[model samples]
Target: MEVDELDFLASSTLYRRKDFLETDEAAKSHPNRNYYYRKNADVDRLIEACTTKLKNNNDNTRALFIRASSYVKKGQLEEAIADYSKLLLVTPDDIDALYQRGTTYEKVGNVDSAIADFTTVLQLNPNHVKAAYARGACQNLKGDFIEAIEDYTVALERDSQRSVSSPKFHARKKDLQSAQAYGGNTSGVPQDAAKDNLGTVERGMSGLSLERQDSMLGQAGSSAAELRDSNGHFAAGSSAAEPRDITGTSASAPGASDPQGAEFYHARGFAHRKRNDYRAAIQDYTRAIELDPKHFKALFNRGFSHDKIGEYELAIKDYTQSLEVDPRNGYAFYNRGITHDRKGDYHKAVDDFSRAIEIDPKNADFYHNRGFSHRKKGNFSLAVSDYTTAIQLNPSHCRAYYNRAFSYDRMQKYHEAVADYTKALEIEPDNATAFHNRGSLYERIGRLQEALSDFGKAIELDPRSALSFNARGLLLERLGRIDEAASDFNRALSLEPNSATFLRNRGLCHRNRGSYQEAVRDFGQVLAQSPKDFATLSNRGYAHRKLGNYSEAIHDYGMAINLSPDSVRLYNNRGYCHAKLGRYADAIGDYSKVLELDPNNIHAHHNRGISSDKMGEFERAIKDFTAVLKLDPYNANAYFNRGSAYDSLGDFDKAILDYTRALDLDMAQGGDGSSQNAKQM
Candidate 1:
């Protein structure tokens, strides 16, 4: 199952008035410092004021910094980089300016430049924890997992030295572990995560279950300012400048103020979740909650982590808590619904999904998942309706189409199912599961050639798909392509050696091709796995009879009959075995059972007549043969056999008359004299 991570929005970084006053005497005397600190100040007016300051003193560091931040807020990343460059010219070793520029570079998709800036910051101040973490994030984005791990470790070590039990320390440790878990590869990370320059530090974790589609951490809804803000530290004069201990106290005391506080912990938890370390992420989120009980992001992410680890009840609790903090958050409701689905509580899942839809009606995943829950509850019509709505909402939603097709199939609407599958394939042409499902549908509807083609395509798309191979084999066997069918079955068995369905299919193929001994071997293997399998037992009995092992065949038939007492075919088969072994009385008894079960069984009557004749009961043999003739009036063998019984009773004229009538009937049917003389039991 593919999962999508929800986007985690981090607070923006804002420079405080004190930062300029402490750095430069010119900034201390500036009259507009108060204006800079005002919330909701017009960004263009700030940029204009900075420009006027720069015109008077071209090297004013304060003006350069303010204008750069203004450009970032305005989404002019290139201009922000230019302002940062000018600041570096005036104060070439300014660590803060270097860090901010690097983040700007990252926002602009210039990852190499960002890494260079971060590296310079680290070179200037080896103890810079934010620099190390930022560099690690850049490295991770670049797929340099080993280097990312080293940087994360450095950050973790430095942070631990500052405060061993701080939320930031745990976050750094989780990041290091996450980098190590990647093992220098990006296999578990989503491809889009690396390509999305705006989310460099918050790549989503992979390997979530199907219910979590669209649940991976993303940068989808964030504006440019938010993205840039996420890259930098929290606002100046916050707890970030003075590190806090685990007790949430001041740095001067036993504990210190955490720079980003609960928000930083929440961000780290997102990182942990992205790495698929749910337990580690949960701890971080719990810490965030401890710091700020009303932190909805922390609560929601904790729930998501819990759900990932299969703690359904706990997940629901966390989601419920998050909703309490922000009642209108549809994602919380949607994820809670997913948890309910995981717990097999379709009613609750539907309720949650409905609430989510009420909050945000345009979300296709909400409808799609609701449809899935409906399907699980055997409400095929409702499932289809929900899936159709999902499809309408998102025309490219391949899973919605595929799942709707399954519902159609359950409802026995084969044509509708086929059309939906076709649409799904159009959306995801490489989906092997879709092809395999469609092929099975085609086979059910008797579109043999199309079924074969679809199966072949599925196998071509996914060479390891044992189901595709087995399905193709069954179709081939039905078409009398025995050798090709056997090869497919062999391939399927090689992929899945213990598949009962594959074994049975190959066994039947072997039997059809007259390899009775091989058929017996395959059936034995199947029965070994499932001792009471009636089909395998019955099939094995037929193979034994073909091999002239009459007693073994009779034993298998008896066992099969024991499992299925009303099986007339099993009784008839056992009767044939008995007759082959010259056990005429036993054969007669078995045949009588078949007749009792199915009174019109012509083969049973004929076989019983032969058994009666072998026991020298001429009158009884004549009666049984008469019954066979009554059922099948044109049976030449019955007429000849009954005539022989009459001869045995010394009724020569009647015997001669019956024999002549049998000969005339055989001639009229274009049968050779050999067929007329041959007596079949």
Candidate 2:
């Protein structure tokens, strides 16, 4: 059959639009008005024409191939496979038929079958780069990383020998690197190829042209005329030279003259980046830039890879270069903003994000990241505004809601913070960090029950999170559930044994429960890690005092007082330890310092009175006791101490009056009205 005969058959049988519309009322009503209907109609017509041709000549390979291609376009994978199988049976070694069938199998997720077909194609044509690339993709999908790497390497070697580069060559190298990076597994690959760490922005591997070409018969640059022989009939034994575009149009095939293009290097770099091999990716991206300094995708992707490896300055430079080429590239601006944020340059981050927003105002991630920069800069109000805009753009943006809640909390808008957290949880209920943060906010606002529930939920969702355990422990301790608090703190410590915060918290709980030795041990551990910690020193001092280790208590208190010289509580605590250790002069001096720092300190006045009386300073003891009484008129201990001082001074009348008053006050306080002195510090 001549090509004219086939063309006549196609023209007559295919696209019988007027005849079909006249017979079919639905077709008439639609009349090519809808794009979907028009497309389906064309495919249906092509299938009908191909079927008629096959009915006349059952072994017509061209008819079968055309029908199979139509079926693929219509998304009828089983039918397409059937047609390709029939075509291959007619011509057992048809490379096009086998490759198409393999692709169809892959589309239907019959990976093993697809691999078998591609393997056969490789056997028939050892230099078939597309077959090698296709098989590698299938193997990669099946988690056969070693096999995938081998196939990709084979494809790369073949392309290198050809001296003419295709994008697939770079893609093959990329897939090889990715396979090696995974080391026979498929973890760390982006679930969505278009998105990277920035979540909503297109980043790594997005620039690679890797879509399957289902509509074309031969290779790229092979026109319909080229597919025919000199007699204008289909050339059944023709081999494809390269992969084609799916739009049935020919793109200029890469020539040997331009084998190492910027795009090729960029593609290879993207693959390396996908595997987190940032150094290798940076090298490839740099080579691409050197080849074509104005290559925008190469520049942008190099920036992304640089940012990944913490080369913020280089990343910024690359992003700036990309922007110079295409100032409207929102992804470049957004990624540069992220790099700036990582470098602690929030002002620059905010500026970059604003530029990204100006280019692509509807991008929620742009607003979201800008909000993060604002929050980092302590602009809580601005952060909230940006987050709100992000939420408005994408209602299901859980991070935006969570971040907005954080800004609200920083602004002290407790109610708004809680509401945003609730909204974020509604969108993503299993977000453990959100739950933990919300629990903290609840605790801060005195909603103890809600706080406990959220903390528990956070722990339940993420049992490995030491933060969740610590937060719950703090809340439980506040609620007086000391045993439960201890359990949580222990768990937190198990997760992070060196956490001084956790140790301090547990120590405080132990102290409250009168586990003085345990409290001392925990506080000591905290001090071992942070020797200059004043709070831990004071806490250890109190624990030692409770354990009757007066010397150790005095040492801790002295260290704490040195760290915080104006701390009245530390001075008073040290003075109490001094009195316990029979160092009356030191105790009096510490108490005097406390009085100087805080004149109305009742403990200091009363304790100083005892210390003075112990040292036989009767008049000075009376003055300190009187000071305590002035500060608190109903102080029975103060009155009794004053009586002792007066008795020592030989003022018998005043001593009797003061003693009588002390007994009356003690009686009123429901204490035994015995003529005993107040308990010593």
Candidate 3:
């Protein structure tokens, strides 16, 4: 573990240095090498005791800070970070803590944090070669060549003893080559020169530290000088740059068609598809098909490209071609299934998805998409089974959990929905849509705190996500945080700008917050987008009624009825507005329309009876209220209205009996007994 032996662990990473330094320091100070071979549990216990002491004493956060270094050496990064994080909190400026944590951060893909930590360490010790090199390496991978070169230069200037040039310069050269390639220019060297430099280029990456893009150098970066457009065309000026195909280029086909040439056409087509030139890409794929009629990749890609451009018929043609050539192509079947799903052909979609799943049982998306098709067909149990299989194959499949949660919600399995959504949100913390969905599920189950927490997290992750903002606004409004609710609604509106749903939802938020003018403005926007939307019209009418704009409220109700004549709710709403305006006949007429749509509706019957009595039709009112009492015998208002109607008909005894019944119903509702008449009525 001395500086000489450190090379074993110092291949590319410096995060393990803390452990190396710790071992060397321990051997130097204690003059014993045997302690380094102690039991792991014993080491852990000692580290814990030291951590406790550090916490209790507010002690030196830097002293023996590399104690967790052995754990790190063994590749236990979680433990290392736990110890480092504890130490960092205690001593924000600890040099070893910053250095060790920076490396660990890079290892865990926290490159930004790693860069910050390394930079801080460099501030403390400007001559820190490893930190400087690591930070520069990260900047290079993140595509900041200027910053990387500056840091690399600084590291070289600070320490001439160490050579950052050998391995690092190769990476720099590759970067330059890559930039040149993307600009439609290549090295233009002899093939031998490129081939010679290729070895150095590939070798240098293995010696450099890569944080986020771990596999970048091997296959991905090796093609830096290669450039092609989406249409499978070579870069603008590099069309003729490739070497001519020799007879030995690929396996020679005895037929007139060239196999490699056919493959090139297909691959080029795929590239074209990536560039979003579906038409040209499809042409290339078709060319491949013409060269080799059984080229499945060409057929599959042509189908996929056609589907992407909404040419479902053409997509189907290519998929059929692929199936004819290679019937067992699960990818082709999966794509064909997607086409069917898009075309609203659920039966064909299910068949294709099922075939794909059968051919490749391990494909998680196949099961997930098939499950969706089942759900669309209302086969809830089948949907659940497929989603469960998908989750089993990919335990972290967030979409499967979310979709399964929907099935559970539809089946009224509220607890199951909550559990599935919980798993989904855990898998993807930044999924604002999932957070909003889970928040709704939580609200259903009356777990308000947990619901609000999810909504808050969703909003934090995506302030511009309008749905998250709207959902959080509703929760706030329910919690009596009216001002906050209004603010969230405003944020939703600002993000969406002109979505009718957002405007309508914000109007409700404004209405609840007593911001009547703002509520009206939001409702106006909704009306502008969807003038005949009855729900928005009726809801806005209610808002108008709240503001004492009786005439405006009546007008809105009238417009709502005009848009949807059969909506019983709209008729009932309009009747209320009419009743408020002393238009008894109009009110009765609307309530009757509600009754005509729903003959057994108790509310309509009762309301119409009241409106009839107001119009001096006591006999008709009595008949309607009597019908309401027959349907709902415990209705207090129905009993009261019937009693008044009987009294209006000069039937004193019947009126008294009805009044007694109304009082009894009220008494039962209140869990108390007063006068029999008052209690029943």
Give the per-residue lDDT of model 1 (tens digit) for 1-681. 001100001112345667667654544555665523223335676677678777888888766776776676677878888998999998999876787787778766687998999899899989777677667667655656567556655765776586668786676556433222211111122222211111211111111111243322111122222311111111101000000001111101111112245644554555556566779879878987998898766777788788767898998999899779778777677778877877889899889889989987997777877787788788989989998998899998776787788779879998999998899889779867677778777878889899889889989988987767877887888888989999999998999899776788789889999999999999999899988888889999999999999898999999999999999989888988888888989989999999989999999989899888888998998998999889889988899899988988999998998898788888888877442542446
Count: clashes, candidate 2:
0
Worst 10 residues of 2 by lDDT: 241-250
Candidate that beats the other on lDDT, 2 or 3, i.e. the better one = 2
lDDT of 2 by residue, 403-462 (tens): 778678768898998898899889878766667777777777888899889888978987
Per-residue lDDT over 366-436 for candidate 3, one digit per residue giving the tens place of the 0 to 100 score: 78777766776778899899989989998977667877887887788989988887887788666665666
Cα error of candidate 3 at position 273, Å: 1.6
In order, candidate lDDTs are: 0.70, 0.70, 0.63
| CA displacement after TM-score superposition, residue 653 of candidate 2 (Å) | 4.9
Best by lDDT: 1
Off by over 4 Å in 1: 1-77, 89-92, 136-156, 163-211, 214-260, 646-658, 672-680
lDDT of 1: 0.70
Q: What is the total number of backbone clashes in candidate 1?
A: 15
Order candidates by lDDT, high to low.
1, 2, 3
Candidate 3 residue 389 Cα shift, in angstroms, is: 2.0
- Candidate 1 has its poorest 10 consecutive residues by lDDT at 236-245
